[model samples]
Target chain A: MSKKKITIAITGLNNTDNPGPGVPFIRAIRESDRFDATVIGLAYENLEPGIYMNGITDKTYLIPYPSSGSEQLLARIEQIHRKNPIDVLIPNFDAELFTFIKNESWLRERGIKTFLPEMESFMERSKDNLSSFGKKYDFKVPKSLPLTGAHQVDQLFEELDFPVFVKGKFYDAYKAWDKHEVNTLFHKISAKWGLPVMVQEFVEGTEVNVIALGDGKGNTIGAVPMRKTYITDKGKAWGGITIDDEKMLSLTYDIIRKTKWRGGMELEMIRTRDNEYYIIEINPRLPAWLYLAVAAGQNLPEAMVRLALDEKLEPFHAFKSGKMFIRYSYDLIGDISLFESITVKGEL
Target chain B: MRIKRSVAVSENGFVFDSSTGDSFNLNGIGREIVELMKNGLEQSDITQKIIERYEVEPAIFEQNLMDFQSMLRQFNLLEE
Candidate 1:
């Protein structure tokens, strides 16, 4: 049979030391034998390395940041669709998922299909709302308080102990050891990611992550649990290996069943010395290390496209445990003209 | 007395439980015990081997072997 052709539009191409999901998501799809896909890279910055990487994107287009408002973001997407209509649109950033979720129907009207969680489901997994979400869902999320002002830092140690995490609203988390550091991170995070930074009580344990896919019907389509073998100073996983984690997988299934999650999600959890699992944060979309799941025999990006196209899929029950992924940095030199075109023409 | 089927001990005393993705390094004595365990040696038989090789008293080596066995069980590296 001839492979079905697909054109997928994806954002989050920032492949720096802190990577994004776009490059790996595209790599997974490109490796698929069932579909011949032409990838359309949607980048927010001209210098995102994936925009110029070979065998990654067929055509690259710079899109307006979603912080500008959904209408403006949609207008830019509409322009891209006029040039090359998107079959399935995958937005891969927590910061941008809000705009995409709000405009789901509008994108569908233009024949661009997307599989994303409802706004309610998305909000339920956010870092600031996690403690309440855990209480409602019967999960063990860490105790956290949202701070809109620096004055709230004084109340932090009163409620929770020190050696806690001072986290930005959308990204970045620093482990603070004292009030001085907490106050410093509060201002730093507030300056960058806006107000209401979260201070979460530290849970001391081995950190484990699970990448999962849900079909929006209380069904877990795929899940793979991994443990980072090496971590960078920024807390990103530099090397990780897949593990047999029935408890973590079970928790993921329960979260999906409860949320009726519609797309790729990642669970950041800590397995305590006593072997209890505490969810630290839940990402609403696939993580920067999503390609690891693909290597474990659950091709979530391919399955997501199929689900977005309304195909039936069975839940994945098994994956290859002990598989490892070690990430490294190498410079992919490109001509200045390539940078000029992406900056000037906004397409490469 | 029996190592889990998924556990592997390398020549350099490196051990890994493939099923759980947990890895550890063992000292020379620990590696020897694990090597004997992997070879299907019973606890009493392994005790004899350790006594001959390390020239330790039988009573003390037996207690240590039992403690090592307990650790193997705790780490899920021993079969039930």
Candidate 2:
């Protein structure tokens, strides 16, 4: 089969203890039988590992972090577009998704396409608004309270109870058994992710996840359910295996059909002994372990690219149920010249 | 009522559940019982088949088979 050539720019290259989806997404795109990809790695820092990984990126450009401002981020992309002309741009970080989603028109004007959910869909599923999202959409979500300062801890236990979940607005979750632990976790999460630490009622159950993609027209492009075989301290899945879960898939389809979501997403849920599923979080992008989905025979990145190109597609129906993925770290040897290139020129 | 259709049972003791991506190893007797279950044999018939071949009493074999089946359920290898 003859494959079309496409140039794609992707962010989220900080593959450390906690990984980013960029490298794995790039790897998945590289395997697309439908498209040959020219990967342009977008980095926020000089030493992002994906920038130096051989053949991972055809070109690497250092971009300003989203915190610096969205206008600056767009300006940098405009510059990168002039040089490389991205056909599709996939922003992988949770922090950066708003910028890309807000500027969807600017990208389209420049001939860069992105299949992202509308701003309304994006905002409604945010952590602060998730409880209402569940109440409106009819899914089970644990009651959540947002904290701006440590003083709010005084009333936390009275509202909820001990052994609640301490979660960052963007990332990180830890189980706090008592008041002291909640305070410690609150300070830790707020210091890094900023104020508005979230305290969630802990659901006792086995954790299951569904990685899914949805078309804008209320159809699921693809969905794969998995149970983690191994997990990290940071609550990342280091090893996982695909499962044949009809209920998980059904719930995902219902959510997509109701929301009419676009692009990639993950439905994180906990299944209790009674077999009831509680929606934990709905992340707006593909997970770092997405290669597991690709290996299981759903190339979501490829499908997203096709969707972004406005190509008609039939929704994916099946994936290998028993496929598994294990995440590991390795050392890639490189010289100072490559590091100097990115540090000095902002491009490698 | 029967072993899961997606289960992969080997001639030896290996058992793999494709639905959950979990695998287990069975003892010789456990392997025979699983093979019988896969073949759609009833518990009484399975006990008869085992007792006819082995020296164990029917009641004893049935008790052990129940325990073995419980283990299968624990590992999520059996159909609910």
Candidate 3:
């Protein structure tokens, strides 16, 4: 007997210097023997390497940017569904997750299933609300102040020290060492991503990350913690090693239990010299480095697919510790005609 | 402009600079331009080749080629 073939639509396929998680997500699915799948790559740019990479996607389609609003995105998804019904959609970008989560019901009505965090869960865990989240969840987060204007930058110095982190709501973080740098970044970030730029205290510690899945019922499906051994200038993990840290695992379980989170999440933290874990960010989707978790034995992406299909699954018991992952760049060879086809026709 | 003699470029667009111990991936156009540079092709020759092969305007191809050359310089792949 053969396993059923599942059609999964995925986004964030930009496998560049700063990669998206789509390629790794598809890799996990391909490695799984439980279910065969036809991977549909939803890309934003014509140059996304995943679209051209062989054995990664069966079909690729261009989608509107999230800035184009949820209505346009839904329309594009609907068009794709008309051609091939999407069994499940696993959106991997932080900026786009809100749009997908907002239209979750509409997608389900169209027979496109998605397992995502509840709206409230997604909202409260954002970087803007991290301080309050830490307060409510009884965890230590770095002191952060949300600045909506230039005037707020002046007051930031009184409350926080120099060398604070200036962060955009969706992306970009720069360490500003003086008031001039703070105000400069404030305007830069505001110009790009709009107001309410975050000012966070620079916590001195080693950075660590955990990728985990929750069952939406306060039960953790699986969790794997890793420490970056080498990071690129863009702050992306180029090499990392999985470690067996009881405290980090416990903290992951506690957060999931508190939020009753559904689907995949990545927790970025900083462990101080004293061994205190200060969670810096909570990404509601799988990280680009999530293949490390699958390689270590969790296979969370496969579990997520099953969970989205409403299949009952037992929590992952154990994963191999001390596993290391070194990311390498692979040049996907293709002709200029393929690029022109996608650029002109919007699909390949 | 000349490509550094120590820069190892594979047919698959994997560029490894032994002097700096850095590796990079290039798109098809980028690889073609770099290969042309290695072969000591003039700027006009490279521009002509790209315009004939790609479905892009000659002016746009020139602008893109300049940008790609700037990136190569930024990555220190060009000889001083």
Candidate 4:
């Protein structure tokens, strides 16, 4: 039987030193034999490598940044939809997701479907709100203080210990061992990402990441836990290996069940030396290393696409253990004219 | 200024220094300047070429180019 053709638009195409999940998500979709997809790459920057990647995206269009407001973003999507109607739009950036979630009904009116968590779920899972989320769910989460100003950094030591993690609201984390370092990072992060910086307790242990899909009905569609073997200076996983940890898997299922989460999510957890699991952060979308889940036979992106299309699927019960992924950089040679085209026309 | 003899650059703006075993990615303008440097072009000549083709001003491009040169040097991709 011939596969049905579908047009799916995805954002967060910035695959750089600090990578985005778009390319990996595209790879998973391409690997699936279930659908013949027209993958549309939505980029905010012209230099995003995925935009220029040959044969990965059928077409590429530049989208307005999230800070430009949802109205502008909706207009851009509508423009793209007029030319090529999109069936599903998977926003892969955490920063842009709030806009997408807020405009879900508007997007649905235009026939653009999305699989995302409810607004409350998305808000509760934020780094600043994780402490309350953990308390409500009866799970272990690091102690975190949300700071709206630089002056709050001075008071952090009173409640939190030294060597706490100073994190931006959307991205970036720096370990501060002293007041000076905390002050510097507080200002630095606040300057770039805006107010409400998070000061999280430093949990020392092995960092384990889990990629999971929820069915929006307290069911975990799939889950894969991985251990970062080598991390870049930017705190990105350079090399990682999947581990067989039932506790980690159970914790993932528990979170999904409790939240009744929908769509793709990545839970960053640390397994302490005392054998306790502390969920550090919850990424609302598929992570940059999502292809690793596909490699491990979970194929979460494919499952997510199926769910988005309203196709019923049984929960994924098994995945291969001991799988590994080592990310490497590749130069995709292109013409100077291509760069000029994307820079000038905002599409390629 | 010159790109180190051991550095390999690809058209896609990927730079690798075999001696240091370090790999780096360059933006489009960075790649253009590096290629021009490889051809033994002076900083002013490369800056002139960039300003002619791109929509950037000479002063801004020169300042950015100097910063980029500093980055190149820090990464050991450049030599005096």
| Candidate 1 chain A weakest lDDT stretch, 10 residues | A149-158
Q: Would candidate 3 be rated incorrect, acceptable, medium or high by CAPRI criteria? A: incorrect
Model 1 Cα lDDT, one tens digit per residue, A260-300: 99999999999886779999999999889889989999999
Better of 3 and 4 by lDDT: 3
Task: Sort by TM-score, best first.
Answer: 2, 1, 4, 3
- State the lDDT at A328 in candidate 3: 85
When sorted by lDDT, best at the front, the candidate numbers are: 1, 2, 3, 4
Scoring only the second chain, what is candidate 4's TM-score? 0.94
Candidate 2, clashing residue pairs? none
By DockQ, who's the top model here? 2
Candidate 4's residue-wise lDDT over A47-122, tens digit each?
9999888878988999998798888888899999999999999999999999999999999999999999899999
lDDT of 2 by residue, A113-221 (tens): 9988889999899887889999999999999988888888988778897789999989999999988899999899999998688899999987889999999889999
Candidate achieving higher DockQ, 1 or 2: 2
What is candidate 3's lDDT per residue for A141-229, written digit by digit as tens? 99999999898777778899988899989878888899999889999999988868999999998788899999999999999988887
* Docking model 4 quality class: incorrect
Which 10-residue span in candidate 3 chain A carries the lowest summed lDDT? A317-326
lDDT of each: 0.91, 0.90, 0.89, 0.89
**Each candidate's DockQ:** 0.59, 0.70, 0.01, 0.01
Give per-model TM-scores.
Answer: 0.94, 0.96, 0.80, 0.81
